[model samples]
Target chain A: MPLNDQLPALNREFIAHFGEMGSRWGINRTVGQIYALLFLSPKPLCADEIAESLEFSRSNVSMGLKELQAWRLVRLRHVPGDRREYFGAPDDVWEIFRVLAEERRRREVEPTLTMLRSALQETPATDDERHAQERMRQMHEFISRLMIWFDDVQKLAPETAVQLMSMGSMVTRVLEAKDRLTGRNTKKQSSPS
Target chain B: MPLNDQLPALNREFIAHFGEMGSRWGINRTVGQIYALLFLSPKPLCADEIAESLEFSRSNVSMGLKELQAWRLVRLRHVPGDRREYFGAPDDVWEIFRVLAEERRRREVEPTLTMLRSALQETPATDDERHAQERMRQMHEFISRLMIWFDDVQKLAPETAVQLMSMGSMVTRVLEAKDRLTGRNTKKQSSPS
Candidate 1:
């Protein structure tokens, strides 16, 4: 039942592509394939079942599952009579997206930001060093700006976030309207009697 | 001077860190170092200069430049009276960021979207297949929503986009205002009808 004999062609293809794409990203190929398998399985699968279904070694499957768990991409469960633990992906794709985004920001973006901050704190000994520090400041500012926006989006209720995203290009009109209102206020404050 | 005798310690540290970080990313260590060198150099540099300064082989330098060029992360120029092409990154970090975002979307996200589309087109033969298809549908919809928002952001003039991102969490207020207006209109249209 856990994708052993009749792993549909659709699921197989999906799993295979994810493996290939996973290597391109930070995740290893085997780990990516393992995640894809868990994601598509109709029920939580124990280690042995996953190993046999994907034709991977038991140790390999175990390692992949451990990696997936660290990514928060898979969850573990236990059956009533069975000693073995099973794993499955969260059912909600948006949850998966949120986890991936947050993890990447934490692991990759945060370190880069720290590096940039330390670089900026140093006093430049030359004009060229000054220029480099300036570039680092620009990079830092851009990432910080993005993080602030992302934080706001992260705070929104999932449905509201979806609604906001669905608004898409229409959000620009709202921006424009806000700008007009702010511009008029500034004009009124500056006008002479 | 092409940083032969007086490569700043600041530049050296920045280049080394970028190389380390770049390997974590898709780019190779040497290539990332090379790009960092070009990015911080006061002027465009020739292959020999890059190779000698970085202590990398001419061939490694050549390959790295080629990779950077493909990413549109570097530009080629000719110094007057010098036949060899010189390389430099865009002076504008925002331009570099925009190019990176666009290139990544085209290379990674677009292909995944296409794969999802093809998978969605296939008919399911069983309940299990239907469940797998449903998950795929959810994944596709989530990515599509993100893409729509990203596309609109990409279309904004760079300054405007910067301002919008700079607005940070304030953008949510706009979202709330838009929702209230739309909610009132719907109420009016349906009231006592």
Candidate 2:
């Protein structure tokens, strides 16, 4: 069926919601809706197909796909007889979780850690500023360690992440154990655990 | 002192990095820089103060302040006898994390869940289409449950979040164990163990 006829009003509303969500996460609304549509779609779709379905410009679809590719949110496919490229999300939702975790850590956490490192090296102007820099250093180190933990997490099979997602409150229990193991009670520890 | 003179080059570099990061996250670059600056500042700053320090337009500062307020990223302060509001990040970084989780869940996750619910109610045209709707149903339910878990996590005290952040790999290990207990072997289970 033609997409316009096949896609109901609910689909459009869902796509629009996703688009708005994309803006919150530092992506455009169109990109979010496009990805959401791809996620719901059973088959890989080409740029023209996506543009037509979403009522977006061809160039806009092109750019959205490009950005999605950079974020590793979409996969490219080539039909056996077709010359055009197609795009789709991974079948497993866990894969999306892994991608989001890894991408956010890279885009947000890593840079903050890097900044904290540089800031720590700078000479403080006075006692008060020195204390603030010290706090920044603590934040940097803490986040760096967290990133390392996430690196270990990414190594877990997609199935493993899926398992963890459903673990619920037990996740918090394990975190508590980890705190005791690390010997870090408060956020600021004078020395490494 | 001029910002160039008062703020070290490294500080400016970090601010610039955050500004760029903001664009990637859908936040205005100046707003990101302003937040980064606030994160590091020893004292709360007024909009005029931020404008003067960053050499940005006063109007930009106003818009940025509004955005920051919406994000719950900046704390409004009242200095003794002063009517002008001062803004700063929470003393604890985990507080920032909690606010981020809550706000994003409310703005992004809840709306998506609503859309998914509506989509689930739509009648499928055929058996194969029914199967597709089933997949979406699983996705929608899982997402809704996950949002609840995040809400629980967000309600946690900052001290607890910091403890978890500091736990590093141990938290993952516990989650791994929890995954085992939850019967995570299946590809898609509507009711997770």
Q: Which has the greatest TM-score?
A: 1
The deviation in Å at residue A103 for candidate 2 is 2.4
For each candidate, how many residue pairs have backbone atoms clashing (under 3 Å)?
0, 3
TM-score per model over all chains: 0.87, 0.80
Off by over 4 Å in 2: A1-3, A126-132, A152-165, A172-193, B1-4, B126-132, B151-162, B172-193
TM-score of chain A as modeled in candidate 2 = 0.80
Calculate DockQ per candidate and list them: 0.42, 0.35
Winning model by DockQ: 1
Task: Encode model 1's per-residue lDDT on B1-193: one tens digit a residue.
Answer: 2334557777887788888888877888889899988888878999998999888889989999999999999999988898899999887666787889889888888888888889899999999889888888878887887787777665553554345443545546655554554553211121211
Instruction: Spell out the clash pairs found in candidate 2.
Output: A19-A29, A26-B25, A26-B26
- Candidate 2 has an fnat equal to 0.35
Taking the true A–B contacts (Cα pairs closer than 8 Å), what share appears in each candidate?
0.46, 0.35
